[model samples]
Target: MNQTQKIQNPETNVPKTPQMNERDFVNDQLTTEKYMTASYNIALNEASNQNLYQDLATIFKETQDCQRNLYNLMFKNGWYALEQAEKQKIDQTYQQFTGYKTQLPYNVQ
Candidate 1:
């Protein structure tokens, strides 16, 4: 069967299937998780209460783990393709960022 092909609904003409719907749902979940983790990090930094910071930190770790699991699952299923950057490009980026440290008056520990 051509599972990859999309078929339109006769009534509303909305093209979708079980597999595609699930894939979309997973993708949405992954995106939501990413946004949530970023928000958690920001909130944690701004948090004044120790208890609140601890709670947010815990949730952040869990969210990060969940995101990693989702990424692994998607990669395993061929749903996600991660392209590898060239070593030269990576080295160039590293050098560029490293040079920014010298430009700043404040030293980064």
Candidate 2:
């Protein structure tokens, strides 16, 4: 089985010129969303006012969801290339995390 399988749909046609294209625009939006999510996360952590925190939290969720949707759209159009992780690697990661689970305040077992 090929472990480096790329999950993507047929790429949409776009003009190849110095000007911005559809893919470029969507990619830019994705980048912006990524930055926004990071900023929101920081703000959420530092927020002191309960009402402001709640409002920011809600907006953060919305922004995060929008970021996901944009990423999906880009993937659907083959704008984003993602490689599948191997099962062995995934299992190793899971095992490592499970080992660290013991450090939690509660028992996970």
Which candidate achieves the best TM-score against the true structure? 2
Residue pairs with colliding backbones in model 2 are none
Ten contiguous residues with the weakest lDDT in model 1:
5-14
List where candidate 2 sits over 4 angstroms from the true fold: 1-3
> lDDT for every model?
0.77, 0.94
Residue range 31-102, candidate 1, lDDT tens digits: 998999999999999999999999999999999999988876666555676555666777999999999988
Q: Write the per-residue lDDT of candidate 2 for residues 1-109, one digit (tens) a residue.
A: 6548887788988999999999999999999999999999999999999999999999999999999999999988988887889998899999999989989999987
Per-prediction TM-score: 0.74, 0.90
- Model 1 stretches astray by more than 4 angstroms: 1-20, 106-109
Candidate 1 collision pairs: none
